[model samples]
Target: MSTSDMQDANLQEALVTYEKLQDIEDDMDEVEVEILRQQDKLCKDIYAKRAEVITKIPQFWPLVIEQAPPDVDEYIQPSDSALLLNSLVNLTVERFELPQGDPRSVSIKWEFKENEYFENKVLEKKFWWRRARDGWAGLVSEPVDIKWKEGKDLTGGMLGLVQKVWEEEKAGKEGETEAAKKLKQLMEDTGLGGVSFFAWFGFRGRKISAEEDKEAFQKEQEHRQARKAGKETEEDAMDEDDDDSDDDEYEMEIFPTADDLAVCISEDLWPGAIKYFTNAQEQDDMSDIDFESDDEMDEDEPEGDAPANKKRKA
Candidate 1:
C-alpha cells in the first residue's frame, strides 16, 4: 500500500477509537446521574421515616439520651439544666458510601442550636458490620465525639492548661502519661492537635485578653438573662467586636471541648483538666468499643492510583 494511504487508514482508526471512548464516558455519566437520583430518593425516604417515628413518640429525647455514649452522659447533664432538652436542633442518620467497591457507612449526627460560644455538634456512635462469609456477626459502635457549646471562647484557657499539662508530662509527674494519652486522643478525634492545629492557627497563637475575658463574662450574663427572658439576641446583635476574622494578630481556631471547658474553670486547672481527659478516655476502655473505621484498618496497603480507590487517612 502507498505510504499516504497507510497514514490515512491509521488516522481513521484513531478517530474511531476516540469516538468509542467518548461514547463510554457519556454512558458512565448517565449511569452516575441515575445513581445520584436513586440516592436522593433513598435519603429523603429515610429522613421522612426518621421524622415520623420521632414525632409519634413523646419520649423521643429520653430514648436518644439513653443511646448517648457514657462519656457524653456527664456532659449532656440529662437533668433539667441539660442543653439537649431545649437546644437539640436536629438529629440525622446519613449514609455515606466509601470508595466504589467498599461498603457504605451510616453516621448519626446531632446538632444542637448554636449558642454564644462554639457550635455544639455530636457524632453519635458509628456502627458497621464486619467482613464475614455467612450471617452478620460483628455489630458494634465506636465512641462518639461530642463538641459542646460554651457560650464564649475559652480557647486561651484551654491552651494554657494544655501547655501546663505538657510541662508536667515532661517533668515525669505522677499520672501524666495517662493524662497525656487522653489528651492525645481528644486532640486527634477533634482535629485540635499538631498539623491540624498549625493549619488553623499558622505560626501565631491566640490568647484572650483580660479586657476580652471581662467582656465575655458580661456577654455570658446577658446571654443568661436573654435565655431566661426567652428572647435570645442574634449573635451579630451582641457586639461588632465579635468578628474574630478581622483580628490579624491572633486567630482563635480550635475551641475547647466540654471536658476542656470544665477543666479551664476548675481551680487546679491543668490537674483537673488532665483528670477530666483521663476519665473520658477510661470510659472508652471499659466500654470495649472500637471507633476506627474499616478504611482505617490497613495502614500498609499500597496507595491507589485513582481518587475513588484512595483510602482516607486519619
Candidate 2:
C-alpha cells in the first residue's frame, strides 16, 4: 500500500479502539454512580431504623440486657454502688458522615440522661461503624468513649468496677467463677446490693418484668406468623379488653426481626450501633485537586476547565 493510504488506515483503527475504551469508561462511571446512590440510601435507612429502636428504649431495653454476652455481668456494681440503672430518663443518637476517607464509615453519638442524679447531668458515648466483612452490612463499634459530669466524682466507682473486670478478664479465660460470685455477695452484704446494672454500662437496663417481656415477645412472633398464614391471632379475635390492658407505654420486642438487628449491628448485636459512608462530593473534590497536582501540563496548554491529568507517553 502507499504510505498515505497506510497512515489513513492506522488512524481509522485508532479511532475505533478509542471509542470502545470510552464506552467501557462510561459504563464504569454509571456503575459507580449507582453504588453511591445505594450507599447513601443504606446510610439513611440504617439511621432511621436505629432511631426507631431507640424510641422503644423503655420497652425493649430489658431484652437487650438479656441478650448481652455474659461477660457484661462481671462489671456490674454491687446494686448499692450509687449506680442507679433505673434512673435513666432518656436516650438519643446522632449520626454523621466523615469529612474524608472510605465513605462507608459513620460516627454515632449516644446520649443518656438520668433524672435523679447530678441534676442536669448527661452521659455521652461515641462509636464508629461500617459494613461487615462476611455478612449483611452492619456496624461494629470502635473503642467506646464515655463522658461524665465534672466535679461529680461519681465515675470512680464505675471505673474501678470496670478495671477489676478487666483484670479478671486478663487473668483468667474461664466464665464466672465462685470467687467472683463471693466477691459480689460480699460487696452486696457490705451495702453494694442492687438490681441489674446494665444501664451503668451504657445499655438501657431492663424496665419491664422479664417473664412479661418474654411472653409479649412470643405473642408478637406468633402474630407475625399468623399474618404470614393469612389467619387472625386469638388475641386479635378477643382483642379489645386484652389489648386495652396493654398500655401504650409497653413494647413487645427490642427488634421486630433478627435480620433488622443483624443489618443494624451485626449478628452479635451490640447495645447500640454506628456506621459510616463516604461523601462523594468531597471525595471528588479531593480527587480533582490530586489530579491537578499530578498532571503534566505544557506551557501552551490553557488551564481553564481542563479534564483530569492526561497520561504522558514514556
Candidate 3:
C-alpha cells in the first residue's frame, strides 16, 4: 500500500476503537445512574415506613384520651372532707354509666393527686370502664381510701372490683331494695343534669336505714300514684284539702348513690362528655393487607402492587 493510504487506514481504526469504548462507557454510566436512583428511592421508602409506624403506634391511645374531658385540678384538690366527698361523687358518677355497658372492664387505671385532703384523710382514686348506650364508657374514679400496697399493682385488681360492682349492680344483687332502686334512678337523672352526689356528703360508709328507706320509698310511690290518679272525689275532696293543708308534713329526703356522689362533687364536670367508644370497620379494598402487620408501610400501600413484594427500603 501507499504511505498516504496506510496512514488513513490506521487513523480510521483508532476512530472506530474510540467510538466502541465511548459506547461501553456510556452504558456503564447509565447502569450506575439507575442503581443510584434505586438506592435513593429505597432509602426514602424505608424512612417513610419507619415514620408511619411511629405515627400509628401513638394514635390509638391518643384517640381514646381525646374523647375524655380535661381534668379538673381545682375541683379534685385533696382535703379530708373533699376526699370523702370526692369518693362519693366519683362512685355516683361511675354509676351513671352502670346501667349502660362496660368501659372499665377493659383497661382500668387510677391516679391520685398529692397533698390534697379533707380533714386529715388521704385520698384514693381510680378509673374503670362502664356501660353506655354507644359502646364502652370510660370513668376516672375519684380518690377513695388509698389502701393500695407497695409492689402490689392495683390496676388489674381494681378492674376486678369494678367488674364485680358492675355485675352486682346489673344483676340487682347489691341494692335490690326498693329504696336502692329509687335512689339509683334519682342519681341517674341528677347526673344527666350535671350534679354529683359525692360533693354533698363529706364522709363515706354512711348506711341508709332499710326501714326508713323503704317507708320513704313507699311514700314517694304513693305520692306519684296520687298524682297519676288525678284530683280527688267530692267526698275525698275534703281529705285532699286536709292533705294539702299538711303539705309540709311530708319531708323530702335525698338518697344518693355512689355514682351520684361522684357526679355531685365533680360539679358540672365532664361537660360534653362522650357517652362511649366503638370499633370502626376496615375498608373492603384494604382487606388484602394483613391486619396484624407490624410494618405500617406494607399495610398502607395500594392493593395493585405485587401482593407479597416488599418495597426496597429508602
- Point to the candidate with the largest TM-score: 2
Instruction: Kindly list the per-residue Cα lDDT of model 2 for residues 222-274, writing each as its tens digit.
Output: 65555456553344344455444333211211111212222243222332422
Tell me the spans in candidate 3 whose CA falls farther than 4 Å from its real position. 1-72, 77-93, 96-144, 147-202, 205-207, 231-261, 264-314
Q: Cα RMSDs of all predictions?
A: 24.8, 26.7, 35.9
lDDT (C-alpha) at residue 214 in model 2: 46
TM-score for all predictions?
Answer: 0.26, 0.27, 0.23
Per-model tally of clashing residue pairs: 1, 12, 46
In order, the Cα lDDT scores of the candidates are: 0.41, 0.40, 0.35
The all-Cα superposition gives candidate 1 an RMSD in Å to the true structure of 24.8
lDDT of 3 by residue, 1-314 (tens): 99999999999788656655655665685586465344434554563554465444333222222233333222222332243333322111222223232322111222233323223232333333232221212332322323334433222133223334334545767435454455445444554232222232212222223344446445544544444455321211235554453342111122123344344323333222222111111222243354445267667778887666553312
TM-score computed on alpha carbons, candidate 2: 0.27
Span of 10 residues, lowest total lDDT, candidate 3: 272-281
Model 1 lDDT tens row, 103-143: 22344455555544345454343333232211112222222
- Candidate 1 residue 167 C-alpha distance from true site, Å: 44
